[model samples]
Target: MIYVVKNGDTLEGISRQTGIPVWKIVYDNQLSDRNVLVPGQALLLLGQGETGEVSGGRAAGGYAYPFIEPEILGQAFPPLRELLVFSYGFTFEGNLIPPPQDDLWMVETAWNNGAEPFMVLTPFSGGAFNNQLVKVLVGHEEIQENLIRQMLAAVQDRGYAGVDIDFEYVLPQDRAGYAGFVGKVRRAMNEHGYRVSVAVAPKVSDSQRGLLVEGIDYAALGENADTVFLMTYEWGYTYGPPMAVAPLDKVRQVVEYAVARIPPEKLVLGIPNYGYDWALPYERGITRARTVGNVEAVEIAAQYGAVIEYAPIAQSPWYTYRQNGMEHVVWFEDVRSIEAKWGLVKEFRLSGAWYWNLMRPFRANWLLLS
Candidate 1:
């Protein structure tokens, strides 16, 4: 589990509470020094082992491994199927590069755990859409076909059970183009008996408009994909004013509209295993936010001798502390909040929940689900 850095929390203290070694904690989290942590930053505790050993809550030889680290492998192994969705990126040459070793491990871990695994093809470059991928799909039609074929073959050959398309920030005019590309990927993968999933923006209504939400054709995506993973996080983000990651009010609106045209069983609500701590007196493009995990929040509370307080409305936890005369606010996930989200999954009869990342280890979450 992630241990957020607090004013008084020490590595030795956290290690004692978790029964993990202090050195392990330092190495697992990539700490350069023994006593330095950002209040809102998250650290992966488990080792970065092969898939099943890390994120896939898989049990091998009758032992289920603990996902103690967000990006590393903690325990030996376990036997449980974890539903995983990977966001794939392309190479500078516009070719569908294989995922890194860590990804393969994650995939293997998921499969070993009895969980179905899918990859969400996306474009990435310094946090923006990769210009190379966009050029091939938008500018080079011939290369697109080859890339699609290669992707289908690779997924099947690599033993993946499904694929999830995660194309974001597409030009509005390319809505039809995006739809057509998805159809092609689906058809190709289906012939090989692979399931197809797509990630979409959470739209409050069919008429929702904007670069972020407008291009997504929910109806078409619902029809083409076996399941649509609704991106319900980031409503409260670093760049924006503080808010709930998946606010109850906003999520209900998105879900109500989506269910109007999409089947519940084919929908999977997205839940964030992380949170953001924005600087107070937020200024436009001036105050950057820090991302954090649940366990860390507790440590932060402990560090400042700050008591953890819960928000009834958001169903989340927060803590207040002072550092160098600067007041701070921290909001993050906890077992309680995660359980609340799971309630929504059941209430909506969603196929399942998808995590934005399986990079951080949250023991509470595993315990709740397992």
Candidate 2:
């Protein structure tokens, strides 16, 4: 359960309202100051006959770019079982492109902090997902084998525990070929005792069609990998109109559609560790929103004297402020959003969470799972 802090809400006030002791609340969420509460901030709740740990144990994974600040990365890994190193892209000819920053330290650090590291393989080139490059690899059987071998070799050289296939923007026509490649990777990795996972675009049904959704055959991919990460966030994005990044209703629809085809336990819920701040009067194709950390978003609200409000439908927190005589809006995750999302994970009995690039300081997020 989650308790949203309100305007003028106190820990004592919350305790009285929810019938839980204030100390337990503080301990569970690791709140250093119970006297201070941000409006719309979500808090975990525990009542009689409930345990915080999910039954049958949960597997938590997260992704992080090699360039994440050392301080932030230090705080991000203790609760995670796996750390997916941001990426190793490939060219049309199947040559591997390593992460820009030296990743040896990153991989070693994750292992030291108790999370096994996995190499992330993608077809991202230049700046965005390269469909043409992905097409080249998926269309040819020889190139697929070469790419897979290079990936496995790199993972082995780095002592990585596994590899995560993260091909995106695959054309709809190449769906079967993509799935076949994933299967081949999974089998080869399994033989070496390294598990394979895949990050896929969320789909509400098999027939859902779009640049992002059309190429994803969720059921087929589910059968091809050891674990599947449903990228359930990003309904609200950088250039698009402002909205919750991961609306609960939207995530649920994706989960519902997913569990019918994929084994629930094999699915990991993909969540965001960051949020977006959009300068409004949004003009499509022109306006770009700046990504903000969840903690930073709250600080922005406070700095601007903005009062955060809860959008109950989305089960997310948002606020608006004026800057340079222009109104701005922010949609970000808070304690409530985490509880709501993890609640779904528990309800559906999914594997656990996989947070996208942990570059921000969202302390309460890790505290909840801890």
Candidate 3:
């Protein structure tokens, strides 16, 4: 079970209330300051009936087949078990559509490399999430059923291990409908011996408001799906201000919330294999960040004679450099950051960690996973 810390709650208080030891709480959550407790912070409480013991070893997984190159896949596929192709989309009428025809070869390659290939389904059009498409599909019961039927057929025909539902920009009004859709899919897939997983936004509370977190009902979805991948990266994004993609503190909050509602074994934390380089003097909508590989970000720093600094709180590496009289900031993951994320998996005893992509070359990350 997970307990949300209240404003005046202490570790000892939570321990007593849940009949769990304070040390267990401190250790499970990796709390450095036991005295300081933030409201909305999730605390894992052991001995709960539904919440079983954390498994000894977690699976290693990643999203591949889109940005990933053939050469990179040859090297990176060995350490991964679950490989979600990115991805197939849906039309407004709930008709299934395939990704680029070229992706089929990558899917075959992943299967040949001993990775479990999962077809990713999304509500995207023209390379962006289409909110209207989700509303239509979830709102109509007949359409939902048709979509799931097609998905099961597709998964079975392609010899896929499962289907990963990556529906984004879902409207809050369709919350119950979305959960219902997942339940329907889970039943259909389980009957056919296929897996059902969902990719959800990083949310710290059920009441957390926003288009990203609103439609996802974590408790309900956890009960229906085989696994749920928390898209924990992108706190610092292409158009947003420069910061760590998945800050340790923010990631911790999300994990805490998720484990409280969903079982730890069914949770997969998301890790980013890429980073961002932003020009300074960021304007809300004007300044844009360029996406860069983790390794490339470091080379950029060295090229500009910039000093790389690590943010202890975020557990991410960043550096500032000047070019053409303009200051720029680059924040990215390194071996140190990857290790910290993997440590979270061990501490929380989660199902495992999955990279947002296998597109870029991050040798250190692969070595760590191996």
Candidate 4:
């Protein structure tokens, strides 16, 4: 069971209310400082039927970006504690851009919540993947070594459990260099008692051609990093056609290909926690989809009297509505859709599922995870 911490609530108080032992709560959450309780903080009070034991063959994880608000973090802390890793970092320009001072609270809070905190290192610039950064890093041996050294230093300084390499839009010619970089980083980090994970684009075949697919050599990366987060979502993007963010068929194909090359135990299926609402009559360049929270999508359906519909093939929930005399369609995850995706974890024998984000309040999703 999950309990949200209210004002003036203490661990002892919560134990009294939930009939769970104080020591058990502290141990399960790995709470080092019991006196520091924030409002809206979520506490997992294991009940009679709940084992709080993860399946040996599977694990669960999520990505918590640097910009998440404290209140959202409080609410998400409970379920995230059960996850294997809570990635709390983002992509920077081969440098570690410290999160805003205010966000440091989340770092401590995450540790208290029992999730192994990971830092994400990426080659993104101004909201898009920068190809030039990848080129510079891969082409210059000295620069690559220096950057990896700095990264390991940052991880050590920040007390992070590991680092996630999220370099995207890498040049196809640098495939060998990319794998080489990961191998070097992994070897160094292993010596330093840190874990290394890599994020790769969803690919159905080794021969898949694309800027995203070409740079990532699955077998080499799998051999290097401890875990590989397969980004299986985003088929329906902000500027694309209206459809499921992570259509089941597409996700399955990626998993099938991944398990063939990467060990199933080291694969983490990416699950999108949010969805998109696109206006009808979408034009390739003119139309843009507005991102909506999973719960907000339902409220939208109710507000507009739109009838929610389920796409059987996609295993996702969607609805159409009219606002300002314009037709709009929304495709988002519900309990049913999320549960269906969880089934894939077992079907593919994957390590677990990793949520794209935890900024939104999806009580149903949390309950399903519980």
The number of the candidate with the highest TM-score is 2
lDDT of each: 0.64, 0.85, 0.81, 0.76
Candidate 2 wrong stretches, greater than 4 Å: 1-37, 43-56
How close to the true structure is residue 147 of candidate 3, measured as C-alpha lDDT?
A: 86
Compute each candidate's TM-score over C-alphas: 0.76, 0.89, 0.83, 0.82
TM for candidate 2 is 0.89
The better candidate by TM-score, 1 or 4, is: 4
Q: Which candidate is the best by lDDT?
A: 2
lDDT for position 197 in model 2: 92
- Candidate 1: 10-residue stretch with minimal lDDT: 56-65
Candidate 3 local lDDT, 1-370, one digit each (tens) = 5465566788888787878788766644445566766443344555433332232246777887565667777656567778888898888777899887556676687788888889999888988998788888878988988888888888877878889999887888888888788888888998988898999999999789998999889998999889999999999999999999999999999999999999999999999989999999899999999999876775676467676677889998888889999999999887667778888888988989889888887654554455
Candidate 2 minimal-lDDT segment of 10 residues: 48-57
**What C-alpha lDDT does candidate 1 achieve relative to the native structure?**
0.64
Candidate 4 residue spans exceeding 4 A from truth? 1-57, 81-95, 100-103
User: Candidate 1 or 4, higher lDDT?
Assistant: 4
RMSD values, in order shown:
7.7, 3.5, 12.5, 8.9
Ranking by TM-score: 2, 3, 4, 1
- Model 1 regions lying over 4 Å from their true place: 1-85, 91-94, 100-102, 130-141
Candidate 4 residue 224 Cα shift, in angstroms, is: 1.3
lDDT of 1 by residue, 1-370 (tens): 4454555677788776767688766644435557665554444444233121222222111111223242333321232243444456775455786544345665676666566666667777665665346545856567677778778877876677877778877766677667777777888888888878788888887676777776788888788777787887788888877666766667767777888889998887777767777667677788777888655655665577566666777777676778667777777776556666666777777766666655565544554454
Clash pairs for candidate 2: 42-336
